[model samples]
Target: MSKLKIGLIGANGRMGKAIIQVLAQSQKSSLSSATVKAGSVYIGFDSGIHSGIKETGVIFDSDLVAACKGSDVLIDFSSHTGFSENLSIAVAEKKPIVIGTTGLTEAEKMEIQTASTQIPIVFSPNMSVGVNLLFKLTEIAAKVLQEDFDVEVLDIHHRHKKDAPSGTAQHLKEVLLRAFDRKEENVIYGRHGMYPERDPKEIAIHTMRAGEVIGDHTVFFLSPEERIEISHKAQDRKTFAVGAVKAAEFLSDKSKGLYNMFDVLGI
Candidate 1:
């Protein structure tokens, strides 16, 4: 059987390099092309060597259109700044895309939702399989606990991560809100002095960025009887890379739809 050809966008970032390494070792998919920002110094370099791996013959370039046209699927780990263009190219070429970009605004996400109607798209903040499971578990716990428990979320990542309350944390907040059938008004970022009291419907998300932590998230459910905590901590970026490749593979045969890791994992 022939391996799936993968065109990667944002081939110079941290996740980009990790995905390149994953494609090098993958049995079901291979890197066909990689794209970097325009005028990037690494533009003409071999994608594999630039990613710290042996030569794979795929060179980094700045042509999103060509890359999208030449591959069976596209995996985008690019910054949110270029996400719309990436999605547009994929849609125009009619190629399925797996999006791993984070820190997207609501407007940007609506663009993805609109684009999904034209091509298959798997968009997720964190593509780690374990993290998706954490999402499901959090939903279940929130449903079972209901209003009896006060819920809070903790997000921790590397100090270099610019976005506070990592996208995963935001997704967790959404999950909790969905399970509780609450609105955004019930969610709080963090506690401050002089608060009257905590609302049972309130969900808090706290963020900490320090050191070189990959990612860590914990959902706390506290009540008078007992406490239940659901957590998923990423030890390496490879977990997300592997999941992104898996998402690409899942979209390879599809035509049009919007999906997430849950759809890929069938959880």
Candidate 2:
């Protein structure tokens, strides 16, 4: 197979740089276009140099269409900001895309769903292979332990990270809900002053932001007799970066639809 050309959105951000470095080392892919947010310092510069790799002549631009026009797939790490416009451009250009953005509103998520009918989209909140495995495991555990144990989710990330509760935590909550046939009302976000005794139907979620920790998540299943904990710790951003590139490869030349990490790893 010929090398796949990949375009990157938010190519000046931390995740963007990591993806670029991973692609630089990968044998099956190469950067075709790199787009930064408007007025970025990296604009007009070689994306390779900004990503700490040798120059590859892919200049960082602000035009999303121009970027997508030059590639077979686009990997987006640029959170919700400017996402709608980028998605529109990708759809108009009929290019496959891998979206790793988090903290999207319900309406934005609906937009992705609508666009998926027109273009192939690999949409995932957490792209780490281990984390996706945790998702599957969490579902299995939830199914087996249904209604017998109280469940809770806890997540910690770098202070610089935005989005409370974290996307991975939310995904885990969804898994538990689906496995147990519960509803969104069952989720309780971080306990605070003067709350009543925990309800059996509630799945409590807690989030912490401190230091430079990459990411850590723990799911607790507590019973009167004992406790079971399942956790995944991300030591670095490279895990996510590498998985996203692999997702791009998985999405290449595929049919139009919305796919998740499960589709990529076949879990």
Candidate 3:
């Protein structure tokens, strides 16, 4: 098979740079273009310099259409806004896309859904295989754990992460709800002083941000005797890089549709 030409959006950001490293090192794929902001210092620069590879012949650019044109897939590890703007261009080009961007608004999500009619896209907050497994495991645990146990998800990330509760926490909530017959009275956010009592069916989510921790997550089933914790800690960013590459491989040359990591990994 020919090489899977991947257009990487946000190539200068941490995850974007990590993906550059991944494709350069992996024998399976190559970067066709690395898209950065127009005014980025890295624009017109070789991706492999800071990406730790001498050169892969792919230059970073801010031209979304030129960057994605004729590519097999576009793997986005950029901001929601950048992804939002780039998405339409990808669809117009009929290129597949794998989105690892977080913090998308509801309207932006609807835009993605509309774009799916013309090109395939995989949108997920976190693409780590372990995190997807955590999503699945939460479903099974929530169903069998009985009414007494409370489902609480806790996530910790580097202090620089701006989104509270993290997208992973919200992903867990969505999956856990699938196993329940009824909706909760409320989704209890980080409870504080004068907080009301916890509802048995409510999914409580908590998050901690500090230090340089890569990412650590725990889903707790709290009951009288003890607590059952199912967690995944990402020691490095490569796990996500691998998953993003996997998503690219999954979507190449396919029909138009919206998908997630669960679909990419066949979970």
Candidate 4:
């Protein structure tokens, strides 16, 4: 059998380069091509060498339709603008898409959903299986934890992140609402000024950015005398790469639909 030919978008970015490394390390994997945005300085560079690995002759091209011409699946860890354009091509070609991009607006999300009806698209706020399981666990924990305890989620990302309260933090908030059967109004973001006493019905989220941390998240159940905290920390980008590859493998023969890491990891 032939190896899966993966066409990677955002090949010049940090996460994209990491995916290339993971693919190179796997014998059963092959990169069909890689892409950066048009006019990027990395257009003519070898994909592997660009990722600090031995040369593999895969040049970073910006032409998505041509780059993905012979690919079995396309994996993207790119930005929203690039992804939106790529989605049109993927839908037209009826190819599977594994999107790891964050910070999409509601309209972009709707676009993804619309495309999923035409092509298989695996979508998730966080691609790491550990984080997805943590999301599911947050629900289970919220269900049984003491009502008096305050639920708080703390997420830490790298200093270069542009968005506050990370995507994972927001996803955790959704899990809390479902498990606790509470409304969005009950969730508090920042409470500095003389806000009154705590509300047991509300869940709070806090974000911290520092250093070169890949990602770290914790959910705290705090009571009078004790606290129970659940945490998941990503030490490297390869974890997401591996998880994404697993998701790609799953989509090989699957029908068109939208899926999250929960569906990929079966949590």
Model 3 compared with the native: what TM-score? 0.95
Q: Write the per-residue lDDT of candidate 2 for residues 72-117, one digit (tens) a residue.
A: 9999999688899999999999999999989998899999999999
**Candidate 2 overall lDDT versus native:** 0.91
**Estimated TM-score for each candidate:** 0.98, 0.97, 0.95, 0.96
Q: Per-residue lDDT for 169-202 in model 4, tens only?
A: 9889988888878899998886688977887787
Candidate 4 off by > 4 Å: none
lDDT of 1 by residue, 1-267 (tens): 999999999988999999999999999999999999999999889988988999889998999998987899999988889888888888889999998888899999999999999999999989999999999999998898898999999999999998888999999999998999999999999877889688889999999999999999999999999998898989889999999999999999898999999999999
In candidate 1, list every pair of residues with a backbone clash: none
Off by over 4 Å in 3: 182-185
Candidate 4: what lDDT? 0.87
Task: Give the per-residue Cα lDDT of candidate 4 at 8.
Answer: 92
RMSD of each: 0.9, 1.1, 1.5, 1.3
Clashes of 3: 0
Summing lDDT over every window of 10 consecutive residues in candidate 4, give the lowest-scoring window: 140-149
Residue pairs whose backbone atoms clash in candidate 3: none
Looking at candidate 1, the ten consecutive residues that score lowest on lDDT are: 190-199
Candidate number with the higher lDDT (2 or 4) = 2
Candidate 3 achieves a global lDDT of 0.84
